[model samples]
Structure formats: structure tokens, C-alpha cells
Target: MRRHLDRIDQLILAELRHNARIPVAALGDRVNLSRNAVRQRIERLERDEYIQGYTIVEHTAEARANVTANLFVYRTDRMRGGEVIAALKSVPEVVICDVMSGEFDLFVRLEAPSVDRVRAVWQQISMMTGVRDITTTVTLSTVIDRT
Candidate 1:
């Protein structure tokens, strides 16, 4: 059983995050590990919760058709593996959330059926504990989305 992620394990996870569909052999080559070894480590990472699962992020036509926005959330306190973030996971429209370094502490990307939905999600987010202020920007269109 794997306890901690070593340097090689970290490298494997990093590559997987960039491209989950990458073949195991290709992943191994990038991380300088044998294919079998890489496979074993990935399995262990999943079991140990170092990795949750593989997923694909796409800018599909359906996705692109929706109202997209970035929410810059200012928090009163630093995150503590807290309920605020956990609550965000339940908001279906929120596709991504990040901890930032500057004026804002949390950044969220939300794609909703309409602008109204985006406002509704914002209301819910603003009411959560630790959330002090939120600034939202609607995305007009994607110039280049590599994600």
C-alpha cells in the first residue's frame, strides 16, 4: 500500500492531470518509469486517495452554448478543508475552483443554462460562511481553450 506520494508518483499525477487520456505507456515514458511500474503506482494512488479518477474537460458545442462566468471570491478566512469548498462541489454549474494568491482567495468557473442561473449560483455562494465578497464576469466567448 502506498502511504506518501514520492517524486515519481507526483510526476505521474501531474502528467495525468494535463491529459488523462494519455496511454499508460506514454505516461510512463514521460515520467521515466516502466509501463508496469507506472500502472501499479497509479492504481495505488487511486486507492490511497492521491488520485480520485480520470476525467475529460472539453469545450463541447453544448458547453460553449451555455453562459460562462468567472467568480472571484474573497474570503474572510483561509480555507480549512472547510464546508465552503465542499459545498461548491454540489453546485453542478461550477466546473472548476482554484485557490489564488492575490486579492481574491478563490476563483471559480461556472457554466450555466442562463445568466439567471449564474446569478442564482452566485447568491448561493455569497451566502456561504467565510465568503465575504464575490465579483463575477460573464465570458463572451473562448478565444482558445486548451483545457
Candidate 2:
């Protein structure tokens, strides 16, 4: 399906991406539209699920000290698919999960407070039932995090 977004909609999205709490009046001023028009557009976007919801991104001190680890997991068996997914979800350190192909069955992105914590997470994953092998790469720096 092709969803067409006008210039005003694009402006609204761009503004929201920068600051979701910006007032509709300010947004209207920025986009050169009436406040009512901006409000209507925002409502439509929300109703159509284009704009899901507003959220805040907190930068905690602990997070500043943390290191991110990306893990590529190859599973030995497909029979325990649900179990594997459930286990992944149970690990709070696993911040992102995706089912992948090629040499790996799953890819996971995790954050730990320190290198020791990353090592502990790797050990925990190594002990999982059907995980055949795990390859981990530590990110030296993050140039972009669209999320």
C-alpha cells in the first residue's frame, strides 16, 4: 500500500522526531499552518497509526557507562523455536531481537553496564539449551541509533 504524506505531514513528523512535546501552536508556526489545521493533521496521523505515541528518551548515568554487544546466534534445533524466543525475551539485557537467516538463526542487541556484565550475558547465552554457537561483537562507538 502506498501512503502519501504531504509536506505539512512531513514537517509535523520531523518536528515530532526532534521533540514530541512541542505544542501544536508552535508546530503550526513552524510549518506555516493554522493551529487548528496542525491539530487536525496530528489527530489524523495518530488515528491512522502513523504517529504511534509520544515518549521520552532518558539518558541515565548507568547507560552512559554501558557497552553494547551484538550477538549472532546459531541454533542447533528448530523444534524449540518458541522456547528460544521466550528465553530471549526473559533476558532483560537483550534490548533488541530479530530472527535472521544465513549462518545465524537469530541476532540480538544487548547493553551491559560494563565489559564484565557483557561477559556474563555471553556466558548465560552459551548455557542455553539449543544455542549451537554464539558470536559476539562489542560496539566501540555508535554513530547512529535511529531508535
Give the clash count for each candidate.
0, 0
Clashing pairs in 1: none
Give all candidate RMSDs, comma-separated: 8.8, 3.6
Each model's lDDT? 0.87, 0.86
Give the deviation of candidate 2 from the true structure as CA RMSD: 3.6
Residue 65 lDDT, candidate 2, scale 0-100 = 75
- Model 1 segments more than 4 A misplaced: 1-61, 79-81
Best by TM-score: 2
lDDT of 2 at 30: 98
Q: Per-residue lDDT of 1-147 in model 2, one digit per residue for the tens?
A: 326799889989999888888898999999999999999998888887888877767777755677899999888885566567788888998999898867788999989888999999899988888888899999998788777
